[model samples]
Target: MEIIILIAVGMLASLCGAIAGLGGGFIMVPILALMYVIPVSDISGTSMAVLFVSAISSTIAYAGQKRIDYRSGLTFAVAMIPGSILGAWTTGVIENRVFFVSLGIFLVLMAISINFKPKKSRDGFLKPNVSRSLLDASGQRHEYSFNMTFAAVVAFFVGFLSSLFGIGGGSVMVPTMILFLAFPPHIATATSMFSILLSAFVGTVSHAVLGHVMWDKFIWLAIGALAGGQIGARVASKIPAIAVVRVLSVCLLIAAVRLMFKG
Candidate 1:
């Protein structure tokens, strides 16, 4: 019964996550804690497996629509790998209460950033000016001119948080890409998901090596998430962009509050 409940929860989380491009770990982790009393040490490992499966499933749907920007995605993925490894390595040593508190703060800030309307870009923002250019996986020359040093620093932080909290880092990565890097929301979502896949995969491996993964539970969760993700991706195309963004922000804010209270 417990396993069944988790699978159901995974399905629901994946559906919302697919539409928002969030990978659903934000939703899954808390619920798992409240209902199953799963240990924090194991949550990241299990969630990473679920995230990996859901991402692959969602990507298949996005691919059909040509919504993925492979170039930007690949570049970000390359940079996130080492960062994720470092993060996973550090997870066991971190205090759980401190981790949750920090994550709460980060999520709240992200929510506020997402809700803010900027006037310069269509999404009401401007990309930061920095100078790093490279060919994306799609063979397009993309430039990242927003203080490479700062971006790397931020990426490292994001990666660390993701490992600590069992999230995919999309909550952090998407906003960073949009507000700081000036990526369009859709492109940012796609790119962030790609980077998350890499980060989650590496993080999971690290956790597994540490004997933190619960394979039986994770497999069932993955199965449900994959199916739900397909449905959510299909629905995403129908939702208005602003509506989606607003809804996503609200959800993130709620989750942040919950995490803070837990802390």
Candidate 2:
């Protein structure tokens, strides 16, 4: 019964994640913490494991539709791996409550940014010839010239944050790609998922080594998420952009509040 409940929750969370292009860790962590009595300290690691499964499933599904941008994905992924490892190491030192609080604040800010009314144009479309270069939240440059050096720096930081917070780093990566690098939202999402796949896999391994993973629980969750993601993706394509954005804003706001109060 417990396992069944978890799988159900995972499916729901993954559905939302696929639609929104989030990694689903935010939803999974809180749900597990509250319902299963999972330790907050282990939430990041466990969430990474779930994310790994969801990323692989979503990537495969999207690939079949030819939606993935391989060049962008590979370039960004190459930079993110090392950063994830560093983040995994850092997790050992930080307090879980502090991390959760910070994550809450980040989510709230992200929601506001996403929901902010655009002053420039009502044109919902992004321009072509937009550069693929990115400037992360830290103000570091991640150029599109396949600059491995710059990518490495940015990927490392992003990876660290992903591991530490259990997010797919899309929350950070998408905005960075769109606002700084000028990539369209859909393209950024595709690229971000590709990058997240690598980081989440690496983070999961680190968590397993640290004995923070709950395999029995994770496997069931993955199964449900895989199925749910496909459904979410289909729905996402049919929904209006304004409606999607509104839904995302509400979800983020709720998640932020929950995380903030959880501590």
Model 1 error, position 83 (Å): 2.0
Clashing pairs in 1: 71-136, 71-137, 118-124, 129-145, 130-145, 130-146, 131-145
Tens-place lDDT digits, model 1, residues 121-220: 5321234434444443345553433444455556666677776667767777777766676555555666666667777788788878977788988888
Residue 89 displacement in candidate 2 (angstroms)? 2.2
What's the TM-score of every candidate structure? 0.85, 0.81
Question: lDDT value for candidate 1?
Answer: 0.71
Where in model 2 is the C-alpha error above 4 Å?
A: 117-154
lDDT string for model 2 (19-89, tens) is 66677776777778787666554777877888888887776665654545576678677778877777776
